[model samples]
Target: MGNWDHLVGASWRGECWAGARAELPLLLGVLPFGLVYGVLGLQAGLPGWAVVLMSSIVFGGSSQVVFAQLWGAGVPAPVIVGTVGVVNLRHALYSASVAQLLAELPLRWKLLLAYLLTDEAYMAAVGRLTSGPRSAVRHWFLFGTGFTLWAGWQLSTLGGVLLGATIPAGWALDFSIALTFIALLVPSLRRRSECVAAAVAGAVALLAQGVPYKLWILLAALAGMLAGMLAQALQRGKSHE
Candidate 1:
């Protein structure tokens, strides 16, 4: 029993390390975005404490940026909630995609992971979780990824808060958000259906740019999924012919 316990501990540590290592590269994209948000939160009149605290509580960078922006704009509480909620709908999809991988975890583990699940963490560790045969320590992999991202975000945001108004407008750190997402997205377009989905989503996003409250994101995601499904169906039909 002692040997067995020791082995399990070692396995857990190894998986955690691997997960964190995989996530390190993506931080290049996430750090700049966090810095931009840090600056934005201050510019939007959020106190330094509030800006850092939101990172802990909200834990969603994009939504946090939207919240700060809307709050600065004097948008009503209800409107802000609606907009933030809308923006975070994509997280539900992320949860669903990884649900099976985590289904067997305990409720406590599930709750912790659900809180930690962010786009970067998910993108960093998911392929590993999904690729091989299920391992006992797989949840640890996600835990490693999520915790590392959480730390990085906090540190980056703190750096931003410290920088405050000093950051140059010419730096354009917010572009990191687009670049990071594009990097995550490009590798995932493995199938023709996925390509179709991305193309349709991109078109819809461009066309809907002026839509209020960033509804274009939701619209683009839905359009992309639909287009992908249609493309997949047509491909299947052709194959059957």
Candidate 2:
């Protein structure tokens, strides 16, 4: 029995390492984005510690960027909260998608995974879970990926903060945040519905650019989701016909 248990433990560890290794490529993009956030947060007058703390706590790149931008603009705290909440609504969808697979996990495990569930981590985990033979200890694979990413983010944020302090503000590194978002967004626009949704949302954002409290972002996200849903539905209908 002791040998059997030892073998199982070794297998689990192997899976975890495999998952972390598989996720390394995605970390390339995440590292740069984290650096961008750290630099922008510092440039926006956020204390270095607060910027690093935010990365550790929030762990969501786009939302963190939005928060830094709003906080730097002197937006009210309540509004910033609401805006960040809206921006992170996609995580709910992610949770729902993976909930069934993780239903057997303990509450503590679920909570930990939920907290670590960023875009890159989720995509990597879901692909692993769906494409391969389902392992009994697959959640450990997720843990490995999430933990690796968490460490990478913290280190990258720290590097950016340190580097940002020495760089001049006139260089305008903050604009790179928008470019980072665009880089992330453009790749996800492969489907027709996705393209339509992005186009509509971009137009709405431009049109509502003057909206107070950055409400335009929320409106644009909603519009994009709706447009994508409608387009998908129409495609399904045509397929049925």
Candidate 3:
């Protein structure tokens, strides 16, 4: 029994490590973004404690940015909430996709993962699962990897808030964050439908850019989702004909 227990513990540890390794690239890419968010949050006049708490509680970079911008600009609270809520609408699709795979998991595990399910982690895990036979352990592996990225984001954000003033304005770490987002987005430009959807979203955002308090981001996301779903349906129809 002692030997069996040791073996089980070792296996669990290995699984966690594998998951963490799979998620490391995303965490690397996310570090700069988190730092940028912290600096921008401070620059936008959000309190330091609010920055840290937002990272821990909200844990959504884009939404956090939107919230900070709205707060600084004195936008109404309802508008801010509505805007952030729209930007986070993608989480629904992610939750549905991952939910099918995690159906056997406990309610608590599902709820926890749903909270932590960012775009990067969801994309990474979906690719992994699609490229192999299904396994019950994949969820645990994803949890490990996603959790690592989450912690890295929080720590990086905290560091930025602390050292933001020291960093030179000309350094433009924020631009590096934008570049990182582009790099992350490049791989996602896979299918023709997806490409079309992205183009449509960009166009919509540009057209709506003058709208108040960053509502355009939400509009862009909605436009992209609708376009992507339409494109997918058309492709499926063509296949059946």
Candidate 4:
């Protein structure tokens, strides 16, 4: 019916805007962090174009920071690359979650969606698609959220790179980056097992702080993932008993 079509049409557009709006807060939260990254990247003597390209191409903030830090320290290229890969291994989880909603889409669309996938966008899109038709307006929502974030991140990084030198030393904004990660992790720590996994990870990272070649980050991540998976398995076994 014409009425049904009109209703679907309206909902699709509205859903996109709604999804974009939902991500607005996160966008604001990430802006300063991105700016900090840009500023630090330049201060560390990374090329301006390299900073922009890293953010534009890789589009992962944490990984970019690690790479810049290691590169500045004169670490080998392979070590820097490996460190970034380890830092971003968490994106695998996001890809798996988003892939479920996109299975029926064309391969081209799936590829584009995969490229757009990020921490905040994936989280928002997954929550929005709980009951909706997968094909209805999910991709639109994803596009709106992902596009907004992509724009914000690019602009913020550029701003930081251009103004890196003038930013005062007393701002103490670097700490905010760690605060942002804490905000992200706090909400994901609902279950006891998740909390334990996080605690174990924090302890390992601290203990391994003196390790060479930044192997501690990789070790900490693998140990945490294993501990969390084991906790879930044990919990499930107990429940089925």
Please identify model 4 stretches exceeding 4 Å from their true place.
1-12, 133-135, 168-176
Stretches > 4 Å off in candidate 3 = 1-10, 127-136, 167-178
lDDT of 3: 0.76
Writing each residue's lDDT as its tens digit, candidate 4 over 118-179 gives 88887767765554443466677777787778889999999988888687644555466668
lDDT of each: 0.82, 0.83, 0.76, 0.76
Of the pair 1 and 2, which is ahead by TM-score? 2
User: Per-candidate TM vs. native?
Assistant: 0.77, 0.91, 0.85, 0.87
lDDT of 2 by residue, 197-221 (tens): 8999889989998998777877888
Q: List pairs with backbone clashes in candidate 3.
A: none
Task: Give the deviation of candidate 4 from the true structure as CA RMSD.
Answer: 4.0
Poorly placed runs, candidate 2 (over 4 Å): 1-10
lDDT of 1 by residue, 1-241 (tens): 0112222344788778877887898888789888878988887789999999999999998889878877876777887887688668778878999998889899999999999999889887777667744578878888999999999999999999999768664454545656656776897688999899899999998999897765676677678879988999999999999
Which pairs clash in model 4?
none
- What TM-score, to 2 decimals, does candidate 4 have? 0.87
Full ranking by TM-score: 2, 4, 3, 1
What's the residue-level lDDT of 161 in candidate 1? 93
